[model samples]
Target: MSTPADPGQAEPQFILYLDGEAYEEELRLLATWVHALLLPVYAREVTSAEPWCPRWWEHQEAIARLHGLWLAWQELTDPAAGPSGPALWHRDHLGAVMHELRSPSGPFAGCKQGSHRPKAVPVVEAF
Candidate 1:
Protein backbone atom coordinates (compact mmCIF):
# COMPACT_ATOMS: atom_id res chain seq x y z
CA MET A 1 0.00 0.00 0.00
CA SER A 2 1.05 3.60 -0.66
CA THR A 3 0.22 6.79 1.22
CA PRO A 4 -0.77 10.07 -0.36
CA ALA A 5 1.34 13.16 0.35
CA ASP A 6 -1.80 15.03 1.32
CA PRO A 7 -3.85 13.25 3.94
CA GLY A 8 -7.16 13.94 2.25
CA GLN A 9 -5.95 13.05 -1.23
CA ALA A 10 -6.79 9.70 -2.78
CA GLU A 11 -4.26 7.41 -4.33
CA PRO A 12 -4.18 7.57 -8.14
CA GLN A 13 -5.56 4.52 -9.91
CA PHE A 14 -4.21 3.03 -13.11
CA ILE A 15 -6.91 2.69 -15.78
CA LEU A 16 -7.07 -1.09 -16.24
CA TYR A 17 -6.51 -1.57 -12.53
CA LEU A 18 -9.62 0.43 -11.66
CA ASP A 19 -13.21 -0.71 -11.41
CA GLY A 20 -16.73 0.80 -11.68
CA GLU A 21 -16.75 4.63 -11.63
CA ALA A 22 -13.01 5.03 -11.34
CA TYR A 23 -12.50 2.94 -14.47
CA GLU A 24 -15.16 4.89 -16.33
CA GLU A 25 -13.64 8.25 -15.33
CA GLU A 26 -10.13 7.19 -16.27
CA LEU A 27 -11.42 5.86 -19.61
CA ARG A 28 -13.05 9.22 -20.31
CA LEU A 29 -9.85 11.08 -19.51
CA LEU A 30 -7.86 8.63 -21.59
CA ALA A 31 -10.30 9.13 -24.48
CA THR A 32 -9.73 12.87 -24.29
CA TRP A 33 -5.96 12.40 -24.45
CA VAL A 34 -6.33 9.81 -27.21
CA HIS A 35 -8.50 12.09 -29.30
CA ALA A 36 -6.75 15.39 -28.59
CA LEU A 37 -3.11 14.34 -28.65
CA LEU A 38 -2.49 10.70 -29.52
CA LEU A 39 -4.70 10.30 -32.56
CA PRO A 40 -4.03 13.73 -34.03
CA VAL A 41 -0.30 13.14 -33.83
CA TYR A 42 0.16 9.42 -34.20
CA ALA A 43 -2.84 7.84 -35.94
CA ARG A 44 -1.75 6.10 -39.07
CA GLU A 45 -3.71 5.08 -42.13
CA VAL A 46 -5.98 2.17 -41.25
CA THR A 47 -5.60 -0.78 -43.58
CA SER A 48 -6.42 -4.47 -43.66
CA ALA A 49 -2.79 -5.23 -42.98
CA GLU A 50 -2.85 -2.87 -39.97
CA PRO A 51 -6.29 -3.03 -38.45
CA TRP A 52 -7.87 -0.50 -36.07
CA CYS A 53 -11.16 -0.76 -34.23
CA PRO A 54 -13.53 2.19 -34.33
CA ARG A 55 -14.62 1.30 -30.81
CA TRP A 56 -11.31 0.37 -29.26
CA TRP A 57 -12.73 0.75 -25.76
CA GLU A 58 -14.85 -2.35 -26.27
CA HIS A 59 -11.75 -4.45 -26.59
CA GLN A 60 -10.23 -5.45 -23.26
CA GLU A 61 -6.77 -5.98 -24.74
CA ALA A 62 -6.88 -2.54 -26.31
CA ILE A 63 -7.99 -0.95 -23.06
CA ALA A 64 -5.11 -2.55 -21.16
CA ARG A 65 -2.52 -1.77 -23.83
CA LEU A 66 -3.67 1.80 -24.43
CA HIS A 67 -3.87 2.57 -20.70
CA GLY A 68 -0.22 1.57 -20.34
CA LEU A 69 0.72 3.68 -23.35
CA TRP A 70 -1.22 6.65 -22.02
CA LEU A 71 0.50 6.36 -18.63
CA ALA A 72 3.89 6.30 -20.33
CA TRP A 73 2.91 9.29 -22.43
CA GLN A 74 1.96 11.28 -19.33
CA GLU A 75 5.22 10.44 -17.62
CA LEU A 76 7.56 10.81 -20.60
CA THR A 77 6.03 14.01 -21.99
CA ASP A 78 6.23 15.94 -18.75
CA PRO A 79 8.75 18.81 -18.73
CA ALA A 80 10.39 17.37 -15.63
CA ALA A 81 11.14 14.22 -17.64
CA GLY A 82 13.84 16.23 -19.53
CA PRO A 83 14.83 16.71 -23.19
CA SER A 84 15.16 13.08 -24.24
CA GLY A 85 11.92 12.05 -22.62
CA PRO A 86 9.76 12.42 -25.74
CA ALA A 87 12.33 10.60 -27.82
CA LEU A 88 12.53 7.80 -25.33
CA TRP A 89 8.73 7.60 -25.23
CA HIS A 90 8.60 7.36 -28.99
CA ARG A 91 11.29 4.71 -29.22
CA ASP A 92 10.41 2.65 -26.17
CA HIS A 93 6.63 2.94 -25.77
CA LEU A 94 5.01 4.17 -28.99
CA GLY A 95 6.19 1.66 -31.57
CA ALA A 96 5.53 -1.48 -29.57
CA VAL A 97 2.09 -0.49 -28.34
CA MET A 98 0.99 0.78 -31.74
CA HIS A 99 2.22 -2.32 -33.46
CA GLU A 100 0.46 -4.58 -31.00
CA LEU A 101 -2.78 -2.64 -31.16
CA ARG A 102 -2.78 -2.28 -34.94
CA SER A 103 -1.36 -5.54 -36.12
CA PRO A 104 -3.69 -7.63 -38.34
CA SER A 105 -3.93 -10.31 -35.67
CA GLY A 106 -4.47 -7.83 -32.88
CA PRO A 107 -7.58 -7.07 -30.86
CA PHE A 108 -9.16 -5.40 -33.88
CA ALA A 109 -8.38 -8.29 -36.17
CA GLY A 110 -11.76 -8.52 -37.87
CA CYS A 111 -12.74 -4.91 -37.46
CA LYS A 112 -13.06 -2.50 -40.35
CA GLN A 113 -12.88 1.29 -40.64
CA GLY A 114 -16.31 2.01 -39.21
CA SER A 115 -17.05 -1.38 -37.66
CA HIS A 116 -16.15 -2.77 -34.28
CA ARG A 117 -15.77 -6.51 -33.90
CA PRO A 118 -15.72 -7.96 -30.43
CA LYS A 119 -13.13 -10.63 -29.93
CA ALA A 120 -14.20 -13.83 -28.25
CA VAL A 121 -12.65 -14.79 -24.94
CA PRO A 122 -10.89 -18.10 -24.64
CA VAL A 123 -12.49 -20.66 -22.34
CA VAL A 124 -10.53 -22.14 -19.48
CA GLU A 125 -11.31 -25.04 -17.19
CA ALA A 126 -11.77 -24.07 -13.54
CA PHE A 127 -9.75 -25.99 -10.99
Candidate 2:
Protein backbone atom coordinates (compact mmCIF):
# COMPACT_ATOMS: atom_id res chain seq x y z
CA MET A 1 0.00 0.00 0.00
CA SER A 2 1.17 3.56 -0.65
CA THR A 3 0.19 7.15 -0.14
CA PRO A 4 -0.31 9.29 -3.22
CA ALA A 5 2.28 11.75 -4.43
CA ASP A 6 1.62 15.42 -3.97
CA PRO A 7 0.04 17.20 -6.89
CA GLY A 8 2.35 17.41 -9.92
CA GLN A 9 4.70 14.81 -8.46
CA ALA A 10 6.53 17.38 -6.35
CA GLU A 11 8.08 15.56 -3.43
CA PRO A 12 4.83 15.00 -1.59
CA GLN A 13 4.80 17.84 0.90
CA PHE A 14 2.62 15.61 3.00
CA ILE A 15 1.77 11.93 3.41
CA LEU A 16 -1.42 11.04 1.60
CA TYR A 17 -3.63 7.94 1.60
CA LEU A 18 -5.47 7.73 -1.65
CA ASP A 19 -7.61 4.70 -2.45
CA GLY A 20 -9.29 5.20 -5.77
CA GLU A 21 -11.88 7.99 -5.48
CA ALA A 22 -12.13 7.23 -1.78
CA TYR A 23 -8.97 8.91 -0.65
CA GLU A 24 -8.27 8.43 3.02
CA GLU A 25 -7.10 11.95 3.68
CA GLU A 26 -7.65 11.56 7.37
CA LEU A 27 -4.75 9.17 7.78
CA ARG A 28 -2.61 11.98 6.51
CA LEU A 29 -4.05 14.39 9.04
CA LEU A 30 -3.80 11.90 11.85
CA ALA A 31 -0.29 11.36 10.61
CA THR A 32 0.40 14.99 11.37
CA TRP A 33 -1.42 15.12 14.68
CA VAL A 34 -0.01 11.83 15.79
CA HIS A 35 3.32 13.04 14.54
CA ALA A 36 3.26 15.84 17.07
CA LEU A 37 1.79 13.86 19.93
CA LEU A 38 3.74 10.64 19.47
CA LEU A 39 7.24 11.85 20.20
CA PRO A 40 6.69 12.89 23.79
CA VAL A 41 4.35 9.99 24.45
CA TYR A 42 5.80 7.33 22.18
CA ALA A 43 9.44 7.86 21.26
CA ARG A 44 10.68 7.72 24.80
CA GLU A 45 9.17 4.34 25.38
CA VAL A 46 10.39 2.86 22.12
CA THR A 47 13.89 4.24 22.49
CA SER A 48 14.30 2.85 25.97
CA ALA A 49 12.99 -0.60 25.15
CA GLU A 50 15.40 -3.46 25.70
CA PRO A 51 16.31 -5.76 22.84
CA TRP A 52 14.64 -8.44 24.89
CA CYS A 53 11.30 -6.75 24.58
CA PRO A 54 8.76 -8.48 22.36
CA ARG A 55 7.46 -5.73 20.15
CA TRP A 56 10.14 -3.14 20.77
CA TRP A 57 11.70 -3.49 17.37
CA GLU A 58 8.43 -3.21 15.50
CA HIS A 59 7.43 -0.27 17.62
CA GLN A 60 10.79 1.32 16.90
CA GLU A 61 10.22 1.27 13.15
CA ALA A 62 6.73 2.65 13.53
CA ILE A 63 8.08 5.43 15.73
CA ALA A 64 10.85 6.30 13.30
CA ARG A 65 8.46 6.45 10.33
CA LEU A 66 6.13 8.68 12.27
CA HIS A 67 9.05 10.97 13.09
CA GLY A 68 9.95 11.15 9.44
CA LEU A 69 6.40 12.18 8.61
CA TRP A 70 6.56 14.77 11.35
CA LEU A 71 9.76 16.19 9.93
CA ALA A 72 8.19 16.44 6.50
CA TRP A 73 5.12 17.91 8.11
CA GLN A 74 7.20 20.62 9.75
CA GLU A 75 8.80 21.35 6.43
CA LEU A 76 5.51 21.52 4.61
CA THR A 77 3.82 23.77 7.14
CA ASP A 78 6.65 25.84 8.58
CA PRO A 79 6.67 28.47 5.91
CA ALA A 80 4.69 31.57 6.78
CA ALA A 81 2.39 31.18 3.81
CA GLY A 82 1.95 27.41 3.86
CA PRO A 83 1.05 26.87 7.49
CA SER A 84 -2.54 28.00 7.32
CA GLY A 85 -3.43 25.94 4.30
CA PRO A 86 -1.97 22.68 5.51
CA ALA A 87 -3.22 23.22 9.03
CA LEU A 88 -6.78 23.69 7.91
CA TRP A 89 -6.53 20.82 5.49
CA HIS A 90 -5.15 18.65 8.26
CA ARG A 91 -8.03 19.59 10.56
CA ASP A 92 -10.62 18.55 8.03
CA HIS A 93 -8.73 15.42 7.18
CA LEU A 94 -8.54 14.50 10.84
CA GLY A 95 -12.29 14.85 11.16
CA ALA A 96 -12.78 12.54 8.25
CA VAL A 97 -10.35 9.97 9.56
CA MET A 98 -12.15 10.03 12.90
CA HIS A 99 -15.51 9.61 11.30
CA GLU A 100 -14.35 6.52 9.48
CA LEU A 101 -12.84 5.09 12.61
CA ARG A 102 -16.18 5.57 14.31
CA SER A 103 -18.28 4.35 11.44
CA PRO A 104 -20.66 1.48 12.10
CA SER A 105 -19.22 -0.77 9.38
CA GLY A 106 -15.92 -0.11 7.77
CA PRO A 107 -12.28 -1.10 8.21
CA PHE A 108 -12.73 0.68 11.47
CA ALA A 109 -16.36 -0.10 10.94
CA GLY A 110 -16.98 -1.94 14.24
CA CYS A 111 -14.52 -0.69 16.81
CA LYS A 112 -15.36 2.76 18.18
CA GLN A 113 -14.03 2.81 21.65
CA GLY A 114 -11.01 4.86 22.59
CA SER A 115 -8.12 6.23 20.58
CA HIS A 116 -7.08 3.88 17.80
CA ARG A 117 -4.74 4.20 14.88
CA PRO A 118 -6.73 4.14 11.66
CA LYS A 119 -5.63 1.75 8.95
CA ALA A 120 -3.12 3.40 6.65
CA VAL A 121 -0.98 2.62 3.69
CA PRO A 122 2.56 3.44 4.72
CA VAL A 123 4.21 5.90 2.38
CA VAL A 124 7.66 5.05 3.63
CA GLU A 125 8.78 1.50 4.02
CA ALA A 126 9.48 0.73 7.67
CA PHE A 127 9.87 -3.00 7.24
Candidate 3:
Protein backbone atom coordinates (compact mmCIF):
# COMPACT_ATOMS: atom_id res chain seq x y z
CA MET A 1 0.00 0.00 0.00
CA SER A 2 1.12 3.59 -0.64
CA THR A 3 1.00 6.52 1.73
CA PRO A 4 -1.38 9.37 1.12
CA ALA A 5 -0.05 12.73 -0.03
CA ASP A 6 -0.07 15.52 2.55
CA PRO A 7 -3.03 17.83 2.48
CA GLY A 8 -0.68 20.77 2.15
CA GLN A 9 0.74 19.19 -0.99
CA ALA A 10 -2.56 18.23 -2.54
CA GLU A 11 -2.86 18.67 -6.26
CA PRO A 12 -4.61 21.77 -7.57
CA GLN A 13 -8.33 21.51 -8.23
CA PHE A 14 -9.73 21.56 -11.75
CA ILE A 15 -10.87 24.99 -12.95
CA LEU A 16 -14.47 23.88 -13.31
CA TYR A 17 -14.46 23.00 -9.62
CA LEU A 18 -13.09 26.40 -8.70
CA ASP A 19 -15.26 29.46 -8.05
CA GLY A 20 -15.09 33.27 -7.65
CA GLU A 21 -11.56 34.72 -7.77
CA ALA A 22 -9.89 31.38 -8.24
CA TYR A 23 -11.90 30.71 -11.38
CA GLU A 24 -11.29 34.21 -12.71
CA GLU A 25 -7.56 34.05 -12.07
CA GLU A 26 -7.16 30.61 -13.64
CA LEU A 27 -9.28 31.56 -16.64
CA ARG A 28 -7.09 34.63 -17.18
CA LEU A 29 -3.97 32.51 -17.17
CA LEU A 30 -5.57 29.95 -19.47
CA ALA A 31 -6.58 32.66 -21.90
CA THR A 32 -3.00 33.90 -21.98
CA TRP A 33 -1.69 30.47 -22.92
CA VAL A 34 -4.47 29.85 -25.42
CA HIS A 35 -3.87 33.14 -27.19
CA ALA A 36 -0.09 33.57 -26.93
CA LEU A 37 1.00 29.99 -27.52
CA LEU A 38 -1.75 27.58 -28.57
CA LEU A 39 -3.49 29.75 -31.13
CA PRO A 40 -0.33 31.12 -32.72
CA VAL A 41 1.26 27.69 -32.95
CA TYR A 42 -1.64 25.44 -33.91
CA ALA A 43 -4.81 27.27 -34.89
CA ARG A 44 -6.03 26.18 -38.33
CA GLU A 45 -8.21 28.09 -40.71
CA VAL A 46 -11.68 28.70 -39.26
CA THR A 47 -14.64 27.24 -41.17
CA SER A 48 -18.36 26.80 -40.76
CA ALA A 49 -18.20 23.12 -40.01
CA GLU A 50 -15.18 23.11 -37.74
CA PRO A 51 -16.08 26.22 -35.82
CA TRP A 52 -14.12 28.23 -33.25
CA CYS A 53 -15.60 30.79 -30.89
CA PRO A 54 -13.81 34.08 -30.37
CA ARG A 55 -15.11 34.10 -26.79
CA TRP A 56 -14.54 30.49 -25.91
CA TRP A 57 -14.63 31.27 -22.19
CA GLU A 58 -18.36 31.78 -22.52
CA HIS A 59 -18.77 28.07 -23.05
CA GLN A 60 -18.64 26.03 -19.83
CA GLU A 61 -17.73 22.86 -21.69
CA ALA A 62 -14.88 24.60 -23.46
CA ILE A 63 -13.56 25.97 -20.18
CA ALA A 64 -13.65 22.55 -18.50
CA ARG A 65 -11.99 20.82 -21.44
CA LEU A 66 -9.34 23.46 -22.00
CA HIS A 67 -8.56 23.66 -18.30
CA GLY A 68 -7.91 19.93 -18.23
CA LEU A 69 -5.66 20.25 -21.28
CA TRP A 70 -3.77 23.15 -19.69
CA LEU A 71 -3.19 21.16 -16.50
CA ALA A 72 -1.78 18.26 -18.50
CA TRP A 73 0.40 20.68 -20.41
CA GLN A 74 1.81 22.10 -17.19
CA GLU A 75 2.79 18.68 -15.93
CA LEU A 76 3.93 17.08 -19.18
CA THR A 77 5.98 20.04 -20.39
CA ASP A 78 7.94 20.29 -17.15
CA PRO A 79 11.64 19.33 -17.17
CA ALA A 80 10.94 16.58 -14.63
CA ALA A 81 8.72 14.91 -17.24
CA GLY A 82 11.83 14.04 -19.31
CA PRO A 83 12.90 14.81 -22.88
CA SER A 84 9.79 13.33 -24.40
CA GLY A 85 7.51 15.42 -22.22
CA PRO A 86 6.58 17.91 -24.90
CA ALA A 87 6.09 15.19 -27.49
CA LEU A 88 3.92 13.18 -25.12
CA TRP A 89 1.81 16.23 -24.41
CA HIS A 90 1.23 16.82 -28.10
CA ARG A 91 0.35 13.20 -28.76
CA ASP A 92 -1.89 12.69 -25.78
CA HIS A 93 -3.45 15.98 -24.74
CA LEU A 94 -3.24 18.75 -27.32
CA GLY A 95 -4.63 16.93 -30.32
CA ALA A 96 -7.67 15.51 -28.56
CA VAL A 97 -8.65 18.77 -26.81
CA MET A 98 -8.26 20.83 -29.96
CA HIS A 99 -10.18 18.37 -32.07
CA GLU A 100 -13.05 18.18 -29.60
CA LEU A 101 -13.26 21.93 -29.22
CA ARG A 102 -13.07 22.51 -32.96
CA SER A 103 -15.15 19.61 -34.19
CA PRO A 104 -18.26 20.48 -36.23
CA SER A 105 -20.52 19.18 -33.49
CA GLY A 106 -18.33 20.39 -30.63
CA PRO A 107 -18.74 23.20 -28.11
CA PHE A 108 -18.20 26.01 -30.59
CA ALA A 109 -20.68 24.60 -33.10
CA GLY A 110 -22.79 27.68 -33.76
CA CYS A 111 -20.05 30.20 -33.13
CA LYS A 112 -18.40 32.00 -36.06
CA GLN A 113 -15.04 33.62 -36.68
CA GLY A 114 -15.99 37.02 -35.22
CA SER A 115 -19.10 36.02 -33.33
CA HIS A 116 -19.85 34.18 -30.13
CA ARG A 117 -23.12 32.29 -29.96
CA PRO A 118 -23.98 31.13 -26.50
CA LYS A 119 -25.39 27.64 -26.25
CA ALA A 120 -28.64 27.24 -24.36
CA VAL A 121 -28.51 25.06 -21.29
CA PRO A 122 -30.92 22.15 -21.25
CA VAL A 123 -33.54 22.63 -18.57
CA VAL A 124 -33.90 20.11 -15.80
CA GLU A 125 -36.88 19.44 -13.53
CA ALA A 126 -36.22 20.14 -9.87
CA PHE A 127 -36.65 17.24 -7.50
Alpha-carbon RMSD, candidate 3: 4.4
- RMSD per candidate (Å) reads 3.4, 13.1, 4.4
Q: What is candidate 1's lDDT per residue for 1-127, written digit by digit as tens?
A: 1123335756556676789987888899888888889888999999999998889999988988888888787777767778998999999999999999999999999899999878977899999
What does candidate 2's lDDT look like per residue over 1-127, in tens digits? 2223334443433223334433345344545566457434433221112111222112333334443445444444555435474665456443453333223443332223332334444499778
Order of the predicted models by lDDT, top scorer first: 3, 1, 2
- How would you order the candidates by TM-score, starting with the best? 1, 3, 2
Give each model's whole-structure lDDT: 0.84, 0.39, 0.86
Q: Alpha-carbon error at 33 in model 1, in Å?
A: 0.7
Pairwise TM-score winner, candidates 1 and 2: 1
Comparing 2 and 3 on lDDT, the stronger one = 3
- TM-score of each candidate structure, all chains considered together: 0.88, 0.30, 0.87
**Candidate 2 — worst ten consecutive residues by lDDT sum?**
45-54
**What lDDT, from 0 to 1, does candidate 1 have?**
0.84
Which residue runs of candidate 3 sit more than 4 Å off their true CA positions?
Answer: 1-10
Worst 10 residues of 1 by lDDT: 1-10
